[model samples]
Target: MSTVADNTTVTEAPVADLTNVLARGPRPKRPSAWSASVTFGWRAVLKIKHVPEQLFDVTAFPIIMVLLFTYLFGGALAGSPREYIQFLLPGIMVTSVVMITMYTGVGVNTDIEKGVFDRFRTLPVWRPAALVGAIFGDMLRYAIASLVILGIGLALGFRPAGGVLGVAAGIALLILFSFAFSWIWTMFGLLLRSEKSVMGVSMLVIFPLTFLSNVYVQPSTMPDVLEAFVQANPVTRLVTAVRTLMDGGWNTGEVLWVVVASAVLVAVFGTLTMRLYNRR
Candidate 1:
């Protein structure tokens, strides 16, 4: 059909033409949960590609922490920089890697601010994929941080008594713990209204946990009250497991505690983050 008005013309397709257009091909299939997650994870990685400076924390920060602490506490605590690095390497690794986990939340809040997630939520793909995939992309940063710290430690003559197996196991455990730990920040990303707020709270919590724990020195040397809190700190538990592994020992108690706690962090915070996500 055709019509003309105001020096303009409009034509409508017939019913058979409309039907042929819609029936041109079968509809595309929806993506699977895992597939969708990986796609979002790749999106996160692409963000890094476009903005390479985002890697500063995973690279430069860990290097600075290692050099600063190794020199600052080396002579007084362990008689030499090399000596202190042995005790500090694994702890520093844990600190650097764990501290970076909060960026996952920051990234989430960034996406939300850009309305990127609004588009994601409207897709027919899995709901949790975006979050999980973002964390997955962050796992690469965690690994890079660990490797940078490890390389610095090695260059400074720090050697794990547990050798290859121990170092590998330690890094693996740290990655797993960090993966679970990222969920807390993800929840905050959803609950908080701003990226600065998420970063502010994350720093407040992380500073106390990292500085007050057994990351820098032995908890046994601290006052009893401080030592008790140090012993109970989750980062302390992680450092213990990591240090023990690097020292050529298997402390099942410490390792199991970390594994179980990691599970709990994910189970609890993962649920909460998803709820916030769905409701958002």
Candidate 2:
């Protein structure tokens, strides 16, 4: 206690209590949603840097597929390896990129298991920041995969009649569609218990959808029932759309159907993922 100039008594508050309050208030400002997303996206890129093996599927797998399919089945399927490659490149591009979306689920599940996900949940950033960042980061993988396929195809004498602009358009469309398709895997990541399980289930579902379509052979050659399934397959439609674009021709019907299908997938799976994320 001390005597004031006016003669009134004064008391000082405890210094330790005030220190704690001031320390709590001085925390760094929470980032905006976009900033948070970009920050997390950078983190994801760094993760890939640390684990370069994450790119094996996008790089090596495409090379193997292009070489294997063109050499092994080209004569039987098409007139020659060259002709088969011309048809096969676009289909393989779409199918391989789509197949890699399952890795998003596996990655997310691994984060959850590692407790990184729970820490993310406590952050003051947008709730979907991690998911969006992961998806955006995957665009790099998609581009790398596309480049690998195109580069190998070109080396193997597979030329695109679509010209550079058309090839560029096809690649852009595939990446856009892949981004939308990833939400379904993200939902699965949130719902599933393990990354291995997610990978297993994703492979189980994806293989049939891809193989049953016109990825490897002409649908016209299939049995009537198989042809119908091939015709209705969304992957087949996407491949057709890509083929048309790569051929420098417009196939509005196929492109529109693929866009509509992608929109529906994004809407459905995005909502489901968010719901599950919140619950978790």
Candidate 3:
């Protein structure tokens, strides 16, 4: 049907025409990858705001670990609790970052369970923005862990012979390692069925690397086989590098190894994570 009013002519289209027109309507422009990633990162950080308790593991765990090791085993391990703290802080910092990285997987798995990832997948932004943004948010957790451990250790008569710059460099390295390590958990988050499973598996991996390495004790004290594993363990390298840096030593060999290991980890796990994410 058609009607004429003033100088305008109006025509009624078929119902299907209106439906088809709407189907072809323009949508909002998609954001750039960086912008999208920042937006997503903000959202990921917001998760902590809503659930403040989620930060307990990062903030409190470092304190507990530092205090426990310093008080309980410090005397036996390093001749005195005070002396042991000097040797233990760097190792504990590395272990703290390693343990906290698992929470990244846990958070991602929780999002998967809640269909948040599905919603993200439907967005017009870059596909990897969700994971990247979450990683950015996770860096804050790493910072908190490192700072708390260092601060508490300082209060407990632990002094870094490397001074401020050394401590800063060591912390920077640890954070870099944590970022690289988180990719492994990111892949597991994408592949695993549940958060609990990821946590269990991650802890299993963490325990051996941390306990078997020169964290609480020197590798020289261990059996040959155990010492061999510790020598090759990346965690050992990281701990040694941090200790060297914080102790004012310029030995770049262990630090180089940590860098290489972190780079390799980022390359392998990052690729795997992206592949699994796309498949999902």
Query: What C-alpha lDDT do the candidate models reach, one value each?
Result: 0.94, 0.89, 0.89
Point out where model 2 deviates above 4 Å.
1-29
Number of the predicted model whose TM-score against the real structure is largest: 1
Give per-model TM-scores: 0.93, 0.90, 0.89
How well is each residue in 4-57 modelled by candidate 2, as lDDT tens digits? 643432233455557776755567988888998888888889998999998899
- Order of the predicted models by TM-score, top scorer first: 1, 2, 3
The local lDDT score (0 to 100) that residue 179 gets in candidate 2 is: 88
Sequence-dependent TM-score of model 1 = 0.93
Worst 10 residues of 3 by lDDT: 1-10
Clashing pairs for model 1 are none
List, residue by residue over 1-280, the lDDT tens digit for candidate 3. 2335522432345555677767565776889999988888898789889999988988889999999989999878778899999999999999988888998888899999999999999988899999988988998889888999999999999899999999999999999999999998988888899999999999999889888899999999899998999999989999999999999996789888888888999899989898899988
Runs off by more than 4 Å, candidate 3? 1-29
lDDT per residue for candidate 1 within 1-280, as digits (tens), equals 2335622422344655677778567788999999999999999899899999999999999999999999999999999998899999999999999999999999999999999999998999999999999999999999999999999899999988899999999999999999999999999998899999999999999999999999898898999999999988999999999999999999999999999999999999999999989988
Q: 1 or 3, which is superior by lDDT?
A: 1
List residue ranges in candidate 1 displaced over 4 A.
1-23
